[model samples]
Target: MARPDIVELPLAGAFHYRPHPHHDHRGSFSRLTCDETLRDAGMNTTWVQTNLSRTKARGTVRGMHYQKPPFDEIKLLTCLSGCVYDVLVDLRPDSPTFGQWTGIELDGAAADTLYIPSGLAHGFQTLSDDVTLHYSHSAAFSPDHQAGLSYRDPQVAIRWPLPITALSDRDAELPNLKILEEAL
Candidate 1:
């Protein structure tokens, strides 16, 4: 596999990596994650869980979710099919970029991955039908530790590239940013 190109995003502890895929007559091969590359960037995470989500409709939104302390998680996200406008919001009160957000278009053709550190909220909107997202997490699932901020919270005010078409009942019920702030 060729060396992965890692770029730090504006938010501290957040990174974007593009793995070099080797093309052949049949197809191509690429290493999705490299410990050496992560080590060089000061990130050393042991992924314990992997998840796959398929969004069937364009404009489908999912997220603004995170795990609380003791179960906080670092997530490595990649789009396996179609495309999405991935979004992340810094939730660490002490962080210089707290409350700030960043969005990127992840295309299956590019095979780019986004590494989201703990203490951040994550979500995405599908730009095309049948989008698939793959995620690797440093921590296992714990429903009791899960929390979220409303994706449409005025305080976060994310400008989704497409009009939202669908949302899970749970995501639709998430507390607003003001409520999250009070709890924080």
Candidate 2:
């Protein structure tokens, strides 16, 4: 096993992966996100909501989504059921990671979690038949404040695990990364 490496990236969030202590075939245990843990990593947002999504197939892509403006939220995400190749793009103009992207492979067997700041775009593609994603948000959901970026945007250059096979009509129409930045 590899030692847990703390990754400090160019953004307004902090993240660290703690190895899960497995005792038997039953499973392992670890906290995905804790107030004190986040605080120590430079994230001070008090999670106000917990959301989960269950995807049925490898190609089930469901994001590049975020809340705009006053409803924008910081998110802490983890994969709890299967595995996924998660991607995040910095959309905050003032951020050092602006226009940059980072990707990680998250799975139930690992104690990996992703911390995404309020102004980044997030999405993932499942690597298994069933994927359950858990997330903590710093704000409430508001349909009117919802926004998204094109998962296929060439500028962002995210390498998805599979060709996008399923997406909502709304998600399909989101502007490309470049256009979204211009519109913002």
Worst 10 residues of 2 by lDDT: 1-10
Quick one: best TM-score, which candidate?
A: 1
Off by over 4 Å in 1: none
Over all chains combined, what TM-score does candidate 2 have?
0.87
Candidate 2: lDDT of 94?
Answer: 80
Against the true structure, what is every candidate's RMSD? 1.0, 2.8
- Measured with C-alpha atoms, the lDDT of residue 141 in candidate 1 is 93
Top of the candidates by lDDT: 1
lDDT (Cα) of model 1: 0.90
The residue pairs in collision within model 2 are: none
| Superposition error at 74 for model 2 (Å) | 0.7
Tell me the tens digit of each residue's lDDT in model 1 across 39-102. Answer: 7788855899999999899999999899998999999998888999988998998899888899
The positional error of residue 147 in candidate 1, measured at the CA in angstroms, is 0.5
Model 2 scores a C-alpha lDDT of 0.77
For model 1, which pairs clash? Answer: none
